[model samples]
Target: MKEIVILGAGYAGLSALHVLQKSSADIHITLVDRNDYHYESTALHEVAAGTQSGEKISYPIMDVVNPKKTTFLQKTVEKINADEQSVLLTDGQSLNYDYLIVGLGFQSETFGIPGADVNALEMVDVKTAAKVYEHIEAQLKEYKTSKDEASLRIVVCGAGFTGIELVGSLVENTKHFAEIAGVKPEQIEIYNVEAADKILPMFSDKLGQYAINHFKKWGVKLMTGKMIKEVRPNEVVYQNGKDGDLESLHAKTIIWTTGVSGNKIVGESGFEERRGRVMVKPNLTDPTYDNVYILGDVAAVMDPASNRPYPTTAQIALKMGHYAGKDILNQMSGKASTPFSFKSLGSVASIGNTHALGLVGKAEMTAYPASVMKKVIADRSLLKTGGLKEVFAKGRFDFYH
Candidate 1:
């Protein structure tokens, strides 16, 4: 049997593994990851806020792949020798493959902002969630004992989905948390800073405004069109359009959700691009080699309609992985392939627990109904990735109920 070696056990990697099992591709498959299980990146903000447990966002990768055809290797990929058609694992083991799939996801892009890397806590994965959880616990402790008002300020950087959801949960949970901690609501303040003029600019203008209003009602402050010039342990300095002078805000906790670049390996592998994305042909293979395929955040898949690369999202990655698997099997069997086409089902960025905004087809919804639809889509993805039984066994569908 031929070999299909996939890197990074993310949406794309896991999806490809599933298709191979269902098709009985009989391809000797080895799935590699640095972590023991897959972390749900989409719902991470809620994880950080303590609304959802960390385990809710992770799944055993082995459960999703057939052991007969697929094997999971827990190790970091040190490097790739594309010229030699081999991959070097961190433990000094090397494997050569007939076909390689790169689905390495993304890393946080600090955008060269000062003090971002060292000071602010980032909400990335389970580990990061734990870190944020610690910070929140520390804040609550300080508020309970400390006489200083300075310890109650929380700075949330970015108005994107992650930032919004994190702050939203902080708003909801912190209120309950404050009662438990015996701190007044006025004592805790949350501020969301955005470089862009608006929040969730990817969504419609109306939805963006709704988010802003809801955040205000929830007691989250807004700082728009401002560039954070500096970030210190106790202060965040920014410059707004109206005043050339810098505006400084004092905060004890700073959570960064500005954005992310592609995974490190994407560029390190000698595939050229910033943020770790490489543009590939319609079949999703590298330009220089037919044996290598890149998907997920690592691939700069072109959107024919917009003539831009597809945003790195779970929906596109899942579909891209399926298509890439079919394409690779065709190549191995000496069969022609239909070019990879992107079918954008839709997009929904959730706000806190019960509010969301998105566009699916020509229709859009706001508030509770939109949020319920988002949960439906999430449950369906879980079902497809795992199975109806697995999805039901976990019973996450009850999140909406």
Candidate 2:
């Protein structure tokens, strides 16, 4: 049997596993991940803000594993020897594969910002996301005793998708935070700092304005056009406007949502990469190895229309995983594999559980309608990675109050 080794059990890896495990092909699958559970990276914002528990967004990797064709290994991948078609694990076990799928996900990128890694909390996975909430709660509880106003303040660095979503969740939980600190919800200040003048640049200006309006209504401080220069303990120093004057936002909770770099293993493996992302061929295979497929955040598939890589999202990752599976099977059957392609359905940003804004196809959505669509999109993602069982268990069906 051909040995197929899949690394990382995130959306892309699991999606590929789901497709491969169903087939009766003469292949044995090895699924490797450090964690035994697969969590929705998209919903990590909710986990960080205490709006959702870590368990709510994650499910066991074994739940979807078909033992007859697949074996799950909880091992951290150290490096990939593409020349030998082998992977070295941290535990000293080397996995040799006839075919390989690399879906190792992202890591926090500080872009060389001073003290960013040490000072700011990161919501990379279930544990880190949960740590954010733990830190937030601890700060709030500290405010009750220390009566420090900074304890009630939250500064989210970067107003990108994750930052905006996290800000929304934080705003949603402000009342609970206020109660803990013996203050009003309005007194819990939430700031979203972004260097870009236009936040959510992927969406239309109108949709972006819609989110900004709601944030303003919810008392969130939007610090657009301010570039974060450094993250200090209980403070975020930023460059203010054209003059480049450095200013600081002092808050007890500083969450880093600036951006992410792909897995370090990619670079360490000696594949030509930028920020841990490989520019794969049209078939989604490594340029140097036809049998090795790279997907998810670590793989950069260029969009010919814009001459830039498509934004790394769960949607594209799923498509890449599915396509990789089909292409592998085709190759096994002695057929020509097709090139991978993707067209986005749309994108949505939830301001809170009740408010959202985005475009669905060509249609614009806002408020309750957009919120419902957001839940539906999340449900679709759940259905894709975890199937009906997981959907029923962790699906977002909170459409109405």
Candidate 3:
């Protein structure tokens, strides 16, 4: 039997596994990941804000994969030998594969910022989000006892999707946190510092303006066109572009949501990578290694319309995974695989539990209606991956909460 090995069980890898398992029984499939569970990466911001528990955002890998067809190996991938068609594991085992899928996800990009790497807290994964949540709670407790204003001050770096989502969640949880800590809600200081001239640069200006207004009404301090110079333990130093003056905020919590790059393993494996992403052919296969497929954050696929690489998001990754599986099956059947194409349904960003901003097709929405749409999208994702059972168990049904 041919050995088909899939590395990393993120959205892309898991989606590929689902498709491949039902496609053919001629090959043996092995799914490898460091963790036994598949994390709902899109909801990591909620995890960091204590709005959702880690358990709520993740499910066992076995729950979604059929053991009869797929062998699940929980281990770390040490290295990939593309020429040899082998993958070395940290447990000192090397596995050979007839077909390989690389879906190893993203890593935080610090851009060589001073003290940002070591000092700022990251919201990249479940573990880091949990840490941030715990730290926030601890600081609240400390502030309650000592009344230290610095303990309540939080400076969030970046004004993009993740950063905005996190700040929105923080806004939602502030009242609860204040109640628990026996402090006034006004005691909490949340500042969103962005180096760009405006937030959500990827979205339309009208949508961006709506978010800005919502934040202003919600008491989130927006510091635009400010470059973060350094992140200290008790303070964040930044330079304002308007005045060219250095300013500082007394913040004990600095959450860095600035940027992300493809997994380093792509470049380390001797593949041609731009920004750590392997440029894949139209069929989502590596140019040098036809049997090797890269998807999600690790694969750089260009958009035909824009003539630029598509942004790495859960939505795009899901579609890529679906296409990658079909292409692999076609290759195995001695048929030419079709080029991958993506149709974007839309995009939505939740401001809080009760509010959101979205652009679906040409239609734009805000507040409660947008919030409902956000929940619908999340529920639909769970339905796609894990079916009705998983949806009932882990789906977001509380649209208003």
lDDT of 3 at 238: 90
Clashing pairs in 1: 262-275
lDDT of 2: 0.93
Better of 1 and 2 by lDDT: 2
What would the per-residue lDDT of candidate 3 be over residues 188-230, giving only the tens digit for each residue? 8889999999898768888889889988988999999999998
In candidate 1, which residue ranges exceed 4 Å CA deviation? 399-401
Tens digits of per-residue lDDT for model 2, 216-265: 88889999999898999999999999678999989999999999999989
Q: What CA RMSD would you report for each candidate?
A: 1.7, 0.9, 1.3
TM-score for all models, in order of appearance: 0.95, 0.98, 0.97
Query: In terms of lDDT, which candidate is strongest?
Result: 2
**Clashes per model (N, Cα, C within 3 A):** 1, 0, 0
Distance (Å) between predicted and true CA of 266, model 1? 1.5
Tens digits of lDDT, candidate 1, 1-401: 88889998887887787777777665889899999887667778887877888778677777787788888899999788889989999899998888999988877778888998888888877888878877777777777787555567788899887787788777767776576457877667888988888888778889888888888787788988888887888788889765668888888788888988778877777876667788888899988888899898888888888888888898888888888888888987789989998777777777777777887765777888778877877776676666665567543555443
Best by TM-score: 2
TM-score of 1: 0.95
